[model samples]
Target: MSAYMVGYARVSTNQQDLTAQRNQLNTLGVPEERIYTDHGLTGTNRDRPGLNQALAAVRDGDTLVITKLDRLARSLPDARDIIEELTKKNVKLSIGGSIHDPSDPVGRLLFNVLAMVAEFESDLIRARTREGMQVAKAKGRLRGKQPKLSKNQEAHVVSLYRGGQHTTAEIAELFGVARSTVYRIVQRTPTLN
Candidate 1:
């Protein structure tokens, strides 16, 4: 069987673009159609569909191409697990156009170093984000997801629901809200005996 390159790209957030990674993979000689990608998925999450597809596409003697080690995996154990799988399948890993040779001691050491760096970076990002959120919460600037209805609006919804003159769908339509929201409002309100 002939060997070919299978490329994988990933972005941790929806706002991040995959164009640069795709371009890099293309420059590495991977065909456009052979590239797989995941959007809005964290590298810490191992259950990405695009990564799975890319791994499945590779065969013995084939190369799995990634723009960077972090793009393939952000944690050291995850990176090592992926590398082990590729090694078991007799497949090579090409990180930024440099093919990794697991058998070589130097190569293994370098790969480990890169994996540790990726994991460290991921940890730093998470820690900084948590700190920022905590600061925001303390300053009352981190009010999460405001309610869809105001107190008055909720009371009106409950009254309309208790009146039993209108159906849930009709009440939702009148208030320009969902039936589920109406149900929630009614569920929380105390019923009058």
Candidate 2:
């Protein structure tokens, strides 16, 4: 089995460049042949084709490297999940740019601490978003995603649906909404209808 220093790079959007990442890995002595790139793919899924192929190609002693933890996954849970999977396969992993190797005691301690901090930070973000929404709602400013149909529009849609004059798809098209929205309104009591 060929021992490989595999590099995985990712970008969330089509406009983002992978060249910089590739160059960095190449400069670090990771051969271009050993780098797997997923451009325009979110780091939210483990189903990346390039990543999968690279992992499959590696032997137990081979190294899997990524620029950073976030480039590999979106959340701590995701990162932890991937790490556990790789560990089970006896594959070595490295966060090539920012993270220290977690093989040693100190490095392992630091990695766990940092992962906890990341999880805490994510929770803060969610809390802030919820608080902001609450404030906006209190101020009478509309908050969250808008319902597909307005109150008056919903009544009209319900009438048409109840009368059975138009199909769900046709009602959806007429109201510039989804078929599910039509169904929801039509299923309501006549008072709401």
TM-scores for every predicted model: 0.83, 0.58
lDDT tens digits, residue span 1-193, model 2: 7656788889879999999888988876689988988888876666888778766766676777777666776667776776666666666667765544445566556666666665666678779998988888999895667777788988888888878888899989998888987887877736542
Each model's lDDT: 0.93, 0.75
Tell me model 1's lDDT, rounded to 2 decimals: 0.93
Instruction: Estimate the TM-score for candidate 2.
Output: 0.58
Error of 2 at 189 (Å): 5.9
- Look at candidate 1 and give me any clashing residue pairs: none
**lDDT score, candidate 2, position 133:** 85
Off by over 4 Å in 2: 1-3, 10-23, 37-53, 73-92, 98-102, 147-186, 189-193
